[model samples]
Target: MLAILREITIPCFFTSYLIVLVLELLRLLGRIPGRGLAVIVMMTVGLFTHVCYVLLRATSIEGVEASMLATWLDWSLLLALALAISFFVFYLMRPDTIVSFFFLPAVLALIAFAVSVRDLPPFTRTEAVEVWRNVHAVSMAGGSAAVLVGFLAGVMYLVQSWRLKRHRAGSALRLPTLETLGRMNRRCLVISTVAVGLGLLSGVVMNLNRWGYVSWTDRGVMLSLLLLVWLLGASAVEFFYAPASRGRKAVYLTLASLGFLVLALVGVLTTPHGQAEKGAAAEPGATIESTTATTVIEETTP
Candidate 1:
């Protein structure tokens, strides 16, 4: 069992999901016998392998860090796992819906991104700050997943609305009603906002504990603040504005929230947001000096 578990790799689940995706596409072409059963079976295999792979990585004793949340690669994989599970849930809830068409691609993309960044170093956290760091990571990842779902729901709502307007009710593609999609979007917005807000707060605590001061100008920090602000505004509108929460307006909010999330993710990738270099624990004096030296070097490099 240990050997089999150890053999589980990214390709294990990736291939399963890829096959499931092909199955889904095949469904669009024509009816195939046992297609739904095949999808469920493949998804189960993929999800099982995915969970095992994550567990192995998180518990491996050969690495400097045993926790899978210690690096970007692991973080991305964790995010993908969360999304894959979500897709599974959505599939079970509405077996006939095309939500998987949108979800599988996102999961694949995250896995691919994780592969590309596998060389990155793990974050270095002191024992005191590790708990808060975990909180920040989990909240951020969970919030990002919610935002992605909300964005997808918004897109589906728009497409469904367009189909209804065009009298395309006879179309082959089946989706939830606008009201259902809108409700999903609204709930996702609320969940994402709360999760990301908690993430940001935890991050602040982690930063203060590690470095004694937060760097407001850091790209990741700036982008996160911007994302949080937008989420807060969107959530306020969802609560206070009666009309905004139920129609195209609500969908637009989720779409824009996704945009902000993309920007924040870009900032994290392009800059060292949570890597060892940025997250390494240091004395307050040494941290300030290091920050100053880094700024000086950057300014003088060109």
Candidate 2:
């Protein structure tokens, strides 16, 4: 059993979520007996296996001083884990609701992306600032999760609005009402704004501590700051300036702000600095330097 768990790959959980998503779509067409039970069981199993994969990855960091997540793949998996866990809880709290239709695709996509980048060079551990870096990474992960939830809520608002406008009254429609979705969207935007703001602030401090000065021009930094500013501006407008127009306007703002966040994240993953392993304790047996985050690590023999 332990050996089987050890061999579990990213596709395992990805496939499981895919199954749940399919089940959800089927449920939307007609009520299938035991569908809710099956979805709950599958999601629970998937979440457990996903946790095991994360633990196994942590064990692989034998020599690194960093936290379990050391690369873009690691961060992506962690973010997926957060979403999976959130979905699992939601499933339990609201059974037969098919909310997974909104979230599972993104989870699967992240898992797929994580698998694609699993071999990328890791961000090496800086012993002096390991804790700070971990905090920064985790905070950003949390902020990203909030943004994702906000995006889903916004989408739900739009769909519910369309359904209502079309006068499609049916017992099969298990979506949250427009008012509920709007409130959730607004709340999630506030949460995303505050969380991303704090995460960016901590990231700046971490960079300054590691490099003696922050890399303000770095693509990732600039893009993330742009996202932060956009979110704050949207939040300000939603809450203070135009509380009356917070319904459809808030939905658009959330979606637009999430787009900026995704763009920033992609920029981070594609940048040269993102591919290099830097900092002290930088992956032993790899070429490294003291001044910049340009240390490339050649693949090692198993």
Candidate 3:
């Protein structure tokens, strides 16, 4: 059992989540009589395995700073873990909510992307900025999760609206009321916008302290700004415009913001940090370590 848990990988949890999603879909189609105990059991097991894998990764490091998330891969793992835990808790509370259609596939994709890019070097942070980096990373992860929730709510709103328009009593019976979906969508939007806005501000502060300037043209920065702006604008419209079809409009805007967020994530993961010290070992004279060592030696001699 120990060995199995130790060897547990992302694919292990990914497959488990896939099965859960399939089961939920089956239940929704009325092929199953009730919210089966099987779905909840499978989801619980998957969440357990997922957590084990993350803990294994977290303890893999060996040094003073080992406790901190050292790389983008670690951050990605945390993000997926957050999403999974939230989903599982929500599933337990509302057994009939059919959100796996969006979240399960997203979890799978995140796992695939993480595995594909696992070879990238981990990000090393200086002590001066490590605290702020953690805050920014966690805030952004929260924001991304909120956006996903909003996106799912939007999708539900459209489906429910369509069923009502067609007067499809059979389908509408399975869906939440439009008001419920709208309230969820609005709440998620507000949370996402606030979290992301704070994240962006923290990033700016970190950059100013470290580099004395923020790179306005950086792809990640530009896309994140675009996402924030869209979220804020959508919130304004949803609250103030008083349009009858505001629900549909809010859903579309949330989906658009999610798209921008995906782009920003790719940009951040692909681009190496400017502070990253690559190939410095080969060019010994220019390494930060060597410079510090020399300074220490000179001070000792004097």
Candidate 4:
């Protein structure tokens, strides 16, 4: 089963990526055919491959069906997949743009990274604080996904501005209108802020329940706070500077948030869990606020 999955998903992902790269090169040289069908096809195939790989990983685990990889790795995969789906929906609604060429590389690279690291080690929820842990993980995953969407919007903003700035009016590319890109970028920022806020609140609850106090100083916690600050700053800039701020300027600020997201994800993945092999020992006597959360955590941990 593992062999088949690796053989198929890996090749499909790589091939699709190559096609997208070629398409990008053509668009850059002013040879754009202006249709996004090829990239869209590639993304859909890549998505299918991504799901199969994840499902195989889950099924191979002894009993924990939901979590089949290390906590960080699992979270990364979920975030990446969510971002890919977001791209698909956005492109479908507004196709025939050079925007696909720019963002598809990130999506393909994420999938390839997932395939490469599928064998590191399976992550299982420790017995202690399972409910809270799941809440933390899911919220973090959702938040990261939101950040990814914001990043995409930022990239689109740049491409649109570049075309406008260079006065390449004769180009065949059918990028989205400036109005659409600006609105999308704004929506992405707002959605990401809300998602990250939930993640932050959940992290605090999980930490207090696990260690008897909030992990206010943990590097991971600190970095997440920094990321929240970055997102909040973007919101403030957008809200108050609307008169002065342009789509391109907003894109620059949004792109800056990428660093914070990366730091936050890596910080959590590499945290010193007690049972290094299985994410250290779970903290005991943790609190659970949601019944659905409890089921998810129990189901995730073996």
Taken over the whole model, the C-alpha lDDT of each candidate is 0.83, 0.77, 0.75, 0.65
**Candidate 1 weakest lDDT stretch, 10 residues:** 61-70
Between which residue pairs do clashes occur in model 1? none
Worst 10 residues of 2 by lDDT: 283-292
Q: Tell me the deviation in Å of residue 197 in model 1.
A: 0.4
The model with the greatest lDDT is 1
List TM-scores for all candidates, in order: 0.51, 0.51, 0.52, 0.48
* Reference-based lDDT, residue 245, model 3: 78
Instruction: Give a tens-digit lDDT track for model 4, residues 1-302.
Output: 66867666456655665675576567666655553566767777778886776566544544322233344455456556666666676667566455556566776666667667766664333322465567667766777776677688778777777888898734897687777877777777777776787678656644443454576777777888899888988877876686566676667777887788898777766775312444233433222324456888999998
Candidate 3 C-alpha lDDT tens digits along 76-133: 7767766777678667767768777777778777777777778877654344256657
For candidate 1, the lDDT comes to 0.83
Per-residue CA lDDT of candidate 1, range 62-148, in tens? Answer: 422223346778778878987898898779868989888899999999999999999977665454368778899999999999999
**Candidate 1 stretches greater than 4 Å from native:** 1-125, 242-245, 278-302
What ordering of candidates by lDDT runs from best to worst? 1, 2, 3, 4
Over 4 Å off in model 2, which ranges?
A: 1-128, 276-302
